[model samples]
Target chain A: MSKNIIIASTSTLHGGDYLEYLLPELSVHFEHCKTILFIPFARPGGVSHDEYTVKVSSALAKINIEVKGIHEYENFSKAIKNAEGIFTGGGNTFLLVNQLYENNIMTILAEAIKDGIPYLGTSAGSNICGLTMQTTNDMPIIYPPSFETLGLIPFNLNPHYLDSDTQSKHMGETRETRINEFHSFNNIPVVGLREGSWLVVKGDTITLKGHLTARLFRQNQTPAEIESETDLSFLK
Target chain B: MSKNIIIASTSTLHGGDYLEYLLPELSVHFEHCKTILFIPFARPGGVSHDEYTVKVSSALAKINIEVKGIHEYENFSKAIKNAEGIFTGGGNTFLLVNQLYENNIMTILAEAIKDGIPYLGTSAGSNICGLTMQTTNDMPIIYPPSFETLGLIPFNLNPHYLDSDTQSKHMGETRETRINEFHSFNNIPVVGLREGSWLVVKGDTITLKGHLTARLFRQNQTPAEIESETDLSFLK
Candidate 1:
């Protein structure tokens, strides 16, 4: 019915070669769409993003797609509200939540997607879709002082996944065990997203990408590994 | 009647004296009781003492009173149930919760204290008493993955107090604000405890000390400074 959602590990400028993994997924929905709205207020982790927006725009232009960083625009309100589609890049989730809460952009962002404007969320952007900010393991280097988040998804997300090494002296609970603890105290399912991987939701079709596997742990039950084609709605 | 509850910052020997402000309140409680059972199990962030029982006993005996590290017992079953008064010390709470959950000691501990054992909990020990481990500001370096704590107190505990210095080059949020972020996700009250200070509970009596004022912050509310004689039952 409508080009819906693209949740990713990160946008092109965020370390990985985003174009190689993202372009194919994006073209599926945005085959005819042009003029993408980009938001970068989420990069408040003290990590400088000299030209995250410019870099992405340059990449999109190579594909004959027109892109613009609309941080400052005429009627900034209307630009985001009526955009053909929007792409949100990854950064510190706390910083993103801080702005979302302060600027009252959460509801409006949700509205844009529900209204049929294709929405793409990367890394920290995807985190805001969870129930609370507690699920994030990011350092509090940035603080919104509030955990309020955009609840586009019912579960928590552990982005940029790394497995715990069982052979080495690098001792610590594996990421799988960490997610287990959340469910020990909480009932929500936590999804681990590996780099270059993504969750694509269009209307009701949800697909996993990058051939990366995810693990799901629930209370009193052992963790189970999930592969591509696994339906996440049942988890909801 | 049970003796008063004295939550200390550490279970290591003499660490309790570091909290001189709590001494007066404990002394008053001692005026009415004869034996005090030191709880070292909560030290590991779990239910079983494992190897810490002998550790607590040796330390307390130096104080010229009868002290038994509950770890002396072969099992946690009889060790906790027989105690007339209990004190839980601070350490890595992850270890504590793991042991507690694995051994199913939380239910036993809660039952013993709720029946009037006059339980005292320090830092890690106190954290477990809360609704969840969400109250602790400890680095997730040793995360047990579960934030579910004892929930004995409705509020979270932010130990090792530090103030915000406007001149600080540290770009991240202050410790207080980071703790405030925790409250944003949950309604649990947060108590900022400075060194040498603690909340002493004897029967219905709750006293504060250590010459340092405490801070209490709630969700969507300005944090307020608390002083001695402050009725903190709102947290318990």
Candidate 2:
């Protein structure tokens, strides 16, 4: 079986409903699976696990998919092992990675994904699909055990990546400057997935999908803007 | 001896020369000291140690103070111990804390500050004067061995803190939201120091300085705006 994944920059774009923009793709992506094991550890807006899980359930119900939060299961590792399809929602990346390690389910999830169970990740979820969580834009609210993350993709992912507004006078480091600083200490490539963009991964092939282009950062090279439908397998 | 420290929100304000706005305060802060040891480990924008040191040197020269980069010394710990004053410049907080741990100089520097060596810190540097680097706004470009920092101040500091710009359409989390999330996981109070604002620590008294009002976030309490000259020693 080939791995099938949708790594999205965000769960919802500005002025869009929760997970509403990706319902069509998700419907087809999880067509063969009836139920999705939802990992709500990210918990955006400081929502409880149960509440976040219900949000996911409501969104997926439109496509006739049943959803269950991993927290609802007796064993999280077992839940991952038994899941036919999985979806990890967006929130704080540090919190998500910390819980994954604390619950000791990282290995199980990686193994299940390697075995080709369909997977969907958005924002913080998409960030964990990379080599490490070092490139995340989220605040360091908590100290995770490690910055290491699932290496489903050869490189790291920078979600909700926005270009600098030239007209603005914000003195904080721009997204490009931050990524370049990451490259100074890390050699891994980073794909800056702008809002409304995602990557579709099937087997050994990965294609960029969405209306916008992504910015790619390589060590010592100028960042390139990749258009929609571009084959990104070469990055692997 | 009483501790004399300046925890500034930024090294440079918008449209200002490096450390230009704070030069008058810094000159008085280091009145009796002829030379100050500089820690440039935070290396903003991927600048080299010597290069960053040079930038600091040029900025301090306006106040007629000599600056020495910590990297130039043979014994980093001993150099910090013998320094009359210490200054940690702003940059990536993760890199700053990582180097402080790797060099095993966190304790030495913390002790020096406690014993009244006259310390000055801006941005990432100021964030480390707190209990941990959890409130920093920098991206996680690297993972430090620990989030623990010098507990010179009893609470955490969020430097370069900006309030929500309602006119903008950006969908990212606000600084207050991030700090609230931090409080959800940890009970420490956070001081959101806006650019141009700083805290002047003399002995056990910490007074909010500069023109702007600082935002204070305590666990389970509404955030309050503190005016200039407001004594924050109670938070200790």
Candidate 3:
């Protein structure tokens, strides 16, 4: 079966309601599903899993879809296998990956997604769709057993990607600089997704979504700007 | 033996020459030493160790302190043991910690500093002085064997820390939010050091240096603004 997924840069856009920017797309993507298995491990603002799930539940309810927290299930593996749809919300990537490993659901979740349950991943959730979480901007509050992820896509992602402000006095490494440094140690490609951008994947086809142009960084090559609607399946 | 250390937030300030802002203090810090050993593993911008060493050499030359790259020595253990002073330049924290562990020098480096070896750590370098590199802002370009660092100080340092830009519309987690999430999983105190600020450790006393105030985050406590010259030794 062909996989269907919406890997978004963020759940909520600036000054927007939760999942506001992507509600149109999500409604269509999850049209046939009546429920979503919400993985709330990446708890934004460090909210509890139940609290995070409630936030997601309220948002998806706009499309008449019910949301259930994965933590509510007695057997996480069985939950992933039986879910009609899946939506993993954004939070800290390190904590998310750590919890996934702790629950031993990293691999199982990947299998279920590949088996083609409609999936939606925002921020930290989208980060795990990559080969590794090495390019994440989240603070390393907790260490996961491994840097490995689902490999749902060929490249890694730097979400909420920002261009360097030449006018700023801050000395922190810019998003571009951080990705360049990653190239120094590893050869994986990285997609720098701006706030409203996302990747829509269908089986072997992947295309950039939203209006913003994404920055693509490949090992030993200059970063290029990718326009919206550009097919990125070749990266695999 | 008493430890003498300078753990700074950055190596260079905006539009300033490298190490220019700290030269006056560094001169006094290394007054008794003529040659200093440099650890260039955190290769900022992916510069080679030799290249990074040259930059440090140029900066310290103003202080009459000759710099030698640690990579030059065949016996890293012996070289660190006999060094007059040690200076670890800033770059990628993950890379720095990985290299430290790869060389089996993480513990030795800590012992040397505790034994009264004057040490200077800027940015990624300063991060290692904490209990772990968990509070760093750098990308996880490589996986280190452990997040453990020198534990030279009682708490962690979040280098190049910036306050939330209330005017900006970007949705990335502010420095404060990231630190707050860290508090949820970890109990270690984190000092958010602005670009110009630093911490001065003399024996068991750790004081905030520079004119800027720092933000301190402790578990279950409200984040507080710390004034310059505030003695933070009690955090130990």
What alpha-carbon RMSD in Å does predicted model 3 have with respect to the real structure? Answer: 0.8
Interface RMSD of each candidate, angstroms, one decimal: 9.6, 1.3, 0.7
Question: Which lDDT values do the candidates have, in the order given?
Answer: 0.62, 0.92, 0.94
DockQ of each: 0.05, 0.71, 0.90
- Cα misplacement distance, residue A221 of candidate 2 (Å): 0.8
TM-score of chain A of 3: 0.99
The DockQ for candidate 1, computed on C-alphas, is 0.05
Error of 1 at B230 (Å): 39
Pairs that clash in candidate 3: none
- By TM-score, the best candidate is 3
Largest lDDT belongs to which candidate?
3
In candidate 3, what are the lDDT values of residues A94-113, reduced to their tens digit? Answer: 99999999999999999999
Q: Which docking band does candidate 1 fall into?
A: incorrect
Candidate 3 regions exceeding 4 Å error are none
Q: After superposition, how far is residue A172 of candidate 2 from its true place, in Å?
A: 1.8
lDDT of 2 at A108: 83
Q: Least lDDT summed over 10 consecutive residues: which range in candidate 3 chain B? A: B227-236
